[model samples]
Target: MTETRFYPKGEGMTLAELAALCEGELRDGADAGHRVDGLAALDDAGPRDIGFFDNNRYAAVLAETRAGGVLIARRSVHLVPPGVAALVVRDPGRAFALAGRALFPDALLPTGLELGGISDRAFVDPSAVLEEGVIVEPQAVIGPRAVIGRGTHVGAGAVIGPGCQIGRDCRIGWHASIQHALIGDRVILHPGVRLGQDGFGYSAGRDGILKMVQIGRVIIQDGVEIGANTTIDRGAIRDTVIGENTKIDNQVQIGHNVRVGRNCMIVAQVALAGSVTLGDGVAIGGQSAVNNHVTVGDGAQIAAISSVAGDVPAGARWGGVPAKPVRDWFREVTWVSEMAKQRRVPEVRHGRDDNDA
Candidate 1:
């Protein structure tokens, strides 16, 4: 079983200290002397944990949590549990996040690279079978236990880690580093793509120092195409899975343990946090980011530059930062266009209008 550490339940900073750290105002609640440490989701909170609510949807769970205290915005102070201390903030989510970080910092990975790599210009295992059409370029390192299937092209300077499995007809681009990763058939990994790198894990000590530990692998299914400079981190615990036929565009950063479903189109510059789940056929536009552990439902469409901070239902089309439905976004865009119309230089219509001769 994975280690589950709890926060400092009763012996930690006061509500006042938390308020100061978040630069928030405390509204009506129990004494500021209340001690808080652990943080949990509103639905899964216990007496030792401090639950938070930024949106009204979680208001139902506010009274249900066994948490000793609650953190909420000033407007929702009335929803606080009876006799429970409240840490009021302008953004309860942000405050809770800060509190969680203070309580549980990530564990980092070790940086112990091998002393010396394989001597051969193209290092391949004897047990592994390569087809006649397969090409392993110079300085390409294929590990001792790795298997590169038929017609696969291992580009120059590519590093395939020990025990890796590359399927048939795959294109492993130049200078790509794949460690502890499984690549399926027909996959196209462009140059500079990094798969199965150690995740950014850090465990904070009493001395306020952090330690790193590498513990995971990456799994890419068949028919996937990863663009140039895209980075896919290995899992922190389980496998970071990219489903079949998924097209990930340039410069995307997919964090550890993420599960991206099949046929998903993740556009350029997208940042998917650790453990995020995307259902099948999801389309994420350029520069969008999904929060950690959030589930994006199937067939959902998110517009460019959107910041998704919450769950999106199946087939939903959303836009904007902290994304909402496209209908809501359309109204907002219309309003913005109306406001900015007068500020812009007036344009003369080239084509004929209704009054044209």
Candidate 2:
């Protein structure tokens, strides 16, 4: 069954149009006049849908796919099923992505927000300043003295707290909350994102646990994209900073005063404890975590599920629990596997004495 989509279906396109849009060459015998109604994965595609095939591991699925056409690597075109048109490209994934964006332009663009107007159901404080071309959707709340720049869209149920400054061409997604934040132009906060929430700071005293107020802001630089349900806590003192062009995945937890440098890619469920600093071009894999006050140098890559507790040098790859250099981790794993195999005891024969002790 095809998955239900929230966005409206795109207008169907001819195979020839799709090939031109994706910068791919149509293989001979492909029906140029055939229309592709939608995009789907290899396993779920129907006769009128277009799909992509890049990995050889899924060659069986490609062979059975019922798609009208497929965006495929030039080397893998032979794997496509009979009757399926092959659009061969140097980079199949990139070509498919381009085709998807072109085909679903409206679905990819921001919706639900009224351009250059505020919905009647939205509440904007009298003192809040909205520049020209700002869009505030239904049930959105704009707090006092907040400044929203032109071409920004605040989605339904989104909250912009007092004194917040959001820059131009930004899109704050539905139900996302922003407080004590300074966001730069073209920043995209996906649905359910929580920015500037209070940091987990408390003092255990004789009287009881004393909560410390989080007064610092979250500074999101231009072109940053934060994924859904990701929470970035406000600093206890200094500001938490996300640098320009950083892309953070869903459900990431960034603690107080964490500094993420430009063009960093933090994958889903990654956690950075308080005061952690990441240099530019770092890539942290899914479910990994960095301990408090650790510094990851520029261009370092942390593998999935790693638990980093110390500083990582620039251009290094780290992995494993209490993360170490990836090569060292691999060596240790190999040694342990060999040792376990060597220690394995062979089962004794029981041919003559079932009851002997």
Candidate 3:
């Protein structure tokens, strides 16, 4: 029943092999030799496709699953069907992810071309230096004196500006424009990612707004994955730094000179203003905005649609407008909601008001 495959799939693996590959253990005397050839959801997975159940919302369907194998937590092992093999782990979601990664490695990380060779339609300047095993696709432009490291793939219509240095095994997506930037190894720049562009720097005076020439660079460290259509502006004086292993979602706007710490997670539509500093392991929810010059401490969690106008302490959970402590925000919201429920309390003394629902 599996159809419409976009990429090549790996060979089928046995239940024992999948368990070992995902660092999981089989439970309830499951047959270790059962073969699983595809991946799918619990309802769609067949006898040959592996499925996963980690969320409470899908608990009801676990008992009736027709799949031969299921990845689930130790606590949920009892819910597995009698004939199915249960692969128990501490984090079933992560284990399932590992299984998917092993089975379909290319799907997780798409290497545009399997064979390492530059396309004839691609344009590499005579002064550019491409290391061995680099793959350049059609319409890609590598400018003068650009140095692309080994095993990197430049997709169609991608533009690597002059003198830009990219490390090995990096993937530059289609139509991505990189200039005045230094990128590290294993970085993935998704389609339409615009880096090292002019920052929004202007001084207002009697003579009108004076644009400050953005001369600094953008430094993207190793293993950082930037999503599609996200724009990281070039620093005005120093450099816009995206720390190692940080994953930024789509449509993010990171202003000039913003320093994002390692392993930080910035969700989609988030805006980090110029000169803002995000400490390591911080996670900001979608559409959150951090004001300029604000510093978010390590491990801080900012809720979705929140605005941070001040410094956030380390490990604190903050939410709401102006972004205060979560508890305080909840309390304030609860109070306002409760207070609003008493409709026309002031008018009660003068006249009885009609109840409106």
> For candidate 1, which ten residues in a row score worst on lDDT?
107-116
TM-score of each: 0.60, 0.87, 0.93
Q: Which candidate ranks first by TM-score, i.e. highest?
A: 3
Cα distance off (Å), candidate 1, residue 198: 1.1
lDDT string, candidate 3, 1-357, tens digits: 466287556677889998888888999689898887778888777888888998878877877788889998888888897888999878888888888877777775544645459989989999999999999998899999999999888988999999999999999988999999999999999999999999999999999999999999999999999999999998999999999999999999999999999999999999999999999999999999999999999999999999999999999999999899999999999999998998566434335544432
Best by lDDT: 2
Question: What's model 2's overall lDDT?
Answer: 0.91
Model 3 stretches with alpha carbons more than 4 Å out: 1-4, 110-116, 344-357
Query: Clash number for every model?
Result: 8, 0, 0
Clashing pairs in 2: none
> TM-score for model 1?
0.60
Candidate 1: lDDT over CA atoms? 0.81
What local distance difference test score does each model get?
0.81, 0.91, 0.91
Candidate 2 deviates by what RMSD? Answer: 3.8
1 versus 2: better TM-score goes to: 2
